[model samples]
Target: MNSMSVWEATANERPKRPVLQGEKTCDVVIVGGGFTGLSVAYHLQQRNVETVVLEKGVVGGGASGRNGGEVLIGYVESMRSLAKKYGRAAARQMFQMSLDSIDLIERIIQEEDIACDFQRNGNLLAAYKPSHLDDLKREQQFLYEAYQFESKIVEKEDLHTELDSSFYHGAFVDERSAIFHPLNYCLGLAKAVERRGGTIYEHSQATKIERVTPDKVIVETHNGRIVAQQVGLFVNAYTTGLHDVIDRAIVPVESIVLATEPLPPALCQQLIKHNRAASDTKRLLYYFRRTADNRMVFGGSGRTASKRDARTLFDKLREGMVTVFPTLKDAKVEYKWSGKVGFTFERIPYIGQLEDGTHFAFGYAGHGAAMSTLLGKLVALNMLNEGDRHNPLDRSRLKPIPFHSQHARAVGIMKYYFKFLDYIS
Candidate 1:
């Protein structure tokens, strides 16, 4: 029962970086060395912009490495839900960008020669109930008719060939997505940034952000400070004690993950025979896949970040795993850990600059791998002014969450409502 995320435990050794010990300067200072910041840095270096990334912990120590590594296409919300919220045109445009983001990941991996076990086996969305299957059918139709996207809907009888489970009513499989070793990818991205003449400081957390002028900002860590013409804050759920307004804009949610010990190859084939990443159609959906080593990496159950009880959540996750695949009842979970991601209203991710002339990108609702990479590139474009500086995903500015202190309670209440909805459906 190790607390280490299977990603970090299995990833290649991350090079040790020195802490910032004195005043340093760069064209852009990026806070948080996770996916977004690294992506921004990587792109900035591509344009030969002097950049420095400061991470509170090691690279990929946050959700960048802790995620389920789905590398999924599109936003967390379905195309229908996105269309209903932001109109069909806007939703379609965003969907295209989301798809492009996956391309960016693939291109980078090939260009950088990063050995992260990158695979394009795609992903599956399973229907836990008959009604859920209907929803999947409608979603599949809407994707093709409205957005010109294609997905295959598997009937209940044929679901087992793909999922090896009789628990699901049906499934929707999208072949455009991918899965990989996220920690390795993050480390590779950092290496790419450095190879392009950028510096990344590990174990150096930005403690204070002081805006000296409209174009000058000073980011201070415990031992040193960074003076930069522009600053980008990519800290997602780990934004606490950085900026109150930015923190309030996001509702931090905990994501618990566990990886079972390597199963027999026969049992592994009895599981995900096609090796596609999968998630169910529940509000608190469980996302899982078979690792390169035949271990089942299953993750789900989000609570407010402040209310992380990994022990209980891990137990529930195991129970859910057994519920879906009874053959895993005796499987031993070798790794268990948890991390956080920003969840915004309407499940829309945000990217914007604050009043003090600092840029930021957050609010991914736990489905941020591709978006973070794309948003980081867009943010870099904003800094370089190469073209349109406007971000389609930006909501102008962040709206401070009302009753911020009671967010945990709100999440708790909503969890129950979602559970009920799952039950009835």
Candidate 2:
């Protein structure tokens, strides 16, 4: 099987855009042409701003195209933890924004006429341990009491209706959550951006940024330079040497996914009857969902090492899949790939301005599919002075990890800790 992601293999063809040549200028220049950068360009172009997006590779080549495609709600931080850390009101607002982010995706897809298999069949947060069910109950109570959001809890016995696996103790279903073909969504956003006069150049990597004036900066790429009044960095896990502070603040964690060959319709129905995306409660979680074409897309965190053999990773993941669904032991693996995800010490995404006033949003943990799009719009709004009266994420100070160089080691330790917890709990 090829190493390409299933999304790339199945996505519609994207039109090519010219590479940046010589020197050009625009009102705003965005770095990293994934969902975040393209979303920013689309929003800015709506307001008649001359926007340009510079991508290191093709759009969605990064985490955007490689993710599980679950349009989940909330950040990596839980609502209860958010309330405890940053007040109930702040947490409520943040939760509201997450819900709004889901709606925004649907709106964009409909307005742009994107045929990305968008669906709102909802998501299941399965509990791996009995104690984890307690945590889900507490979370459910908080969601109901604080936000009046309703979600159903499925007992272990009834989980068969939602999931075929007997590995889960129970599950919580959030009807508002959704899923879609992420690569097509990225390409659709690019088309919408270009239709609105925003320029997107592929294979044009931004290598350096030189601030010419207080409000103007010049981004130097291999073949061209772009001068803009504002520059926004949305590179996330792929960031390298862009800005010392931003680079140091992010820890790139590798996540790998593998897809099984398409199953029979009856078998697909038996696997996930309702087509809801599902993930378990382990700290090193296992997320799985049914693709539109009836294949099972399963993913999990890879070992903390930067370089890992693809075949070994796929074997481990396949073992995990069999442990969850014994019938899958014989399923033919069709695709295998990995992408780096940006995680911050704070766990929540960061949206702030640099010392020179360049705006940036990154570190989405693993919930970036929806959060990135929302943050991109918010960043554009903040730039236009139309965002919230007080955006906490934009105002927060981002501190790097204490021992940044040992990030991989730290992640390795955390993985072992989680495994231990899974064993004991």
Candidate 3:
């Protein structure tokens, strides 16, 4: 089987760009070329700002292309938890931003005329256990009562119309959720950035960032440098010593995904009738969807170490897929790959300026598909000194994760804990 992501295999050819070669200057320099960085660049260019984006690899080489392609709403933390911690009004605003993020994706696709198989068929959150269904019911009610959002709960008996498998007790369907070809979307954004006069350089890894003055910072790449008035760090899970403060605040967890060979159209319909992206209600969750070409794309995270062999992880994921859909036991696996997800201690993404005045945003905790886009736009607005009134992320505190040096072991332990919860519940 191929070790490349299905998105990478099927996506249109990404336009080539030159690597940064020498010293340059721009109004703002962005690190990383994933969704967040690309979105920031796109928005900044719209405002006619001189922006340059530097990527160690090609666009979408990170989690932007490696994700499950579930264009979902809301944060990794539940709405109830957000409300309890940050008051009802603030929680509602955050949730509205999540919804707005989805709208932003649709708007960009329509205005830019991006052909990325964007669809709003909706999303399904399946209940792994009977008790899990109760949680879905409560969540549905909370959304309606508090935020005026509507979602339908599929009873166990009615779930067959939505899914062919009996693995889930029930499910919550959010019609607002959508799905698309993630890599294509990223490439389209890259093109849009260029169309608007923004510059992006691939294979230009930023090695060091030094503040030369109060408003000027020099970003050193392997072969070049950029002097900018402001810098935005959008390197999420790929964060390392490049920015120690932001790196310390994130915990990287590896997630693996596998894709089956294209199945018959009827079989694909049987697997997921409405073709909605779906995920189970588990800490170590399993998310699956039907690709545009009728392939079954399944992804999940488990207790395995990140250093484990790709084939071993593929086998484990295939086992889980077979358990969910017995008829897929003999399905030919075609693609397998993995990427890291960034998680924060609070389980909420943060956006703010660092001590040295470097604007930053990250730590999506596996919900980066939409949140990253929204945060990127907000970061641009923050940079432009506009719309400070509507940005909730600005109020968030970015604290270093406690005991972060042992985060890998901590994630492993949490995986087992979540497994036990899945078993008992």
Pick by lDDT: 1 or 3, better one: 3
State the lDDT of candidate 3 residue by residue for 84-147, as single tens digits: 9988988988999999999999999999988888989999999998998998899999999998
Name the lDDT of candidate 2. Answer: 0.89
Number of clashes found in candidate 2: 0
Tell how far residue 335 is off in model 2, in angstroms.
Answer: 0.2
- Candidate 3, superposed: residue stretches over 4 Å from native: 302-309, 395-397
Candidate 1 lands at a TM-score of: 0.97
- Distance from true position, residue 344, model 3, in Å? 0.6
Predicted structure 1: lDDT: 0.87
Task: Count clashing residue pairs in model 3.
Answer: 0
Angstrom error of the Cα, residue 398, model 3: value is 2.3
Candidate 3, run of 10 with poorest lDDT: 302-311
For every candidate in turn, the CA RMSD to the true structure comes to 1.7, 1.3, 1.4
lDDT of model 3 at position 330: 87
Tens digits of per-residue lDDT, candidate 2, 154-256, equal 9999999898899999998999888999999999999999999999999999999989897789999999999999998899999869887788889999899
Give per-residue CA lDDT, model 1, range 322-368, as digits (tens): 98889999999999888886887757788877777788888888668
